[model samples]
Target: MSTYLTILGYNSAIPTVNASPTAQFLDMEERAFLIDCGEGTQVQLRKAKVRFSKINHIFISHLHGDHCFGLPGLIASFRLLGRDTALNVYGPKGIKEMMETIFRLTETHKGFEVIYHELKSKSSEKIYEDSRIEVFTIPLDHRIYCNGYLFREKPKERHLNMKEISKYPEIQTCDYHHIKSGRDFELSDGYVLKNSILTTDPTDPISYAFCSDTRYWEEVIPLIENVDVLYHESTFLHDLKEMADHTGHTTALEAARIARKANVGKLILGHFSNRYSDLSVFTDEAREVFPNTFLPKALEAVKIG
Candidate 1:
């Protein structure tokens, strides 16, 4: 199984030639999830060559315009493309009302069913799960009700050792599954074959956390601790700490601090303010605290091991 994260937009509030608002695509275990649908998200998706139909779930961190303004247009575009599969949109409360109002006023009828999951929990909670992945919400401190998301891959089954199994002709094809499940195999001679000899341990499950549009919230540290990748909002430099706090945003230094405290594998800084033309300053300041920090380019995919 492979996991990747593509940053579609990374600007804060205002969209510029080099950056857009908050939007990303998380591809894990062959499933695609859209995180935050800011303005021009659809256009970015096309530029990134993402198959829009593969994305069935859209998660909005908050109700802010920079975080969710592109949802209506994306939904309408889906309808125009003749999408009939059910679409699930998860966000804070009032999201459904806001989208419904827009659709009703525009007389836009969706070809697919749009299901909304309203999030109001202030504590970390599991919101979505499947055979391969589980999604949890990390309550964030923002001006509005905002929640970050933790994407965790489920533990995989042990890999079958084909060479070892080939040596035992009595081990039928149907028995491979049992062997992979850690079951002992019995031969016709009544000899017991240990599962450890037939299969190897699977790779460790990986997790990714997406934190955006929030202040320096320490509560998120425990929820996202030890994640493979942590994509946190760094809207300003440490020099503008007061402004960042007043606006309920995190500075690059603050984001790096949280990443270090949480002991995450890699830290990705994004959601940059338009005031700064040179992003190297943010990287320099963050690397001072967390050396493993990274600044992702738009439409660039980062592989998660």
Candidate 2:
């Protein structure tokens, strides 16, 4: 299966006329995840033509207004649409209290349950996993409690080798499942046919990492090493790196350096500062360090692998 990422919004600090704050929609391994619900996130998701029902989980990087202000509105919308399934929300420790307070104050009644998964860990840890995908947290260095998520597809079973299996008459169609599961085939005479000789390896698993609103952090290299696609925040140019770090943000050049060190297949620089009229400057600066660096196109769905 392939992974698709849609940049719902990629601006920093606040919403601009052309862009909104940090938000993204990730569709990986048949699972849909909404990452960071900034202002105007629901509108952006609608603009991108994404089905609201597809998203069962929402991940907020931090409690920053620009990163999670739209969450209440989105959850309310889900209720209005007659959603009956439970929603899982993962975020910093205060997220559950923050959201429940908003709902309570607004007298917003929900027809479904909203499960909260609050995180306060400083070290990296696994948060969600299924048969096909596994998600882990990438502890980030931000002003507040924050985390980046890594989505990795699980390894698939080997493909059946019809040519090799046809050589043996005793190997019936029922045995194909066992062979594909990497089990050896044995004959009545005690001769064995190795699984490696009968089947080919499956496709390599794909992975995507979303690192938002963090300073220049090198400790995340091992956690996200060699990912298929990486979306890291680049809120400033190199000239404003001091300010960027001071505000718990990363420069475009620094993001590229992280991508290079981690050996990622591609780097997507986003969460840009509105101060720069020309967005191309980010790509120009990052490409100097990592040639595969690219800028995020808001509302566009990009295939990660």
Best by TM-score: 2
Residue 56, candidate 1: C-alpha displacement in angstroms: 0.5
C-alpha RMSD between model 2 and the true structure: 1.0
After TM-score superposition, what is the CA distance of residue 16 in candidate 1 from its true location, in Å? 0.6
Candidate 1 least-lDDT 10 residues: 173-182
179-258: candidate 1 lDDT, tens digit per residue:
87789899999999888999999899989999988999999999999999999999999999999999999999999999
By lDDT, the best candidate is: 1
| Model 1 score (lDDT) | 0.94
What ranges in model 2 sit over 4 Å off? none
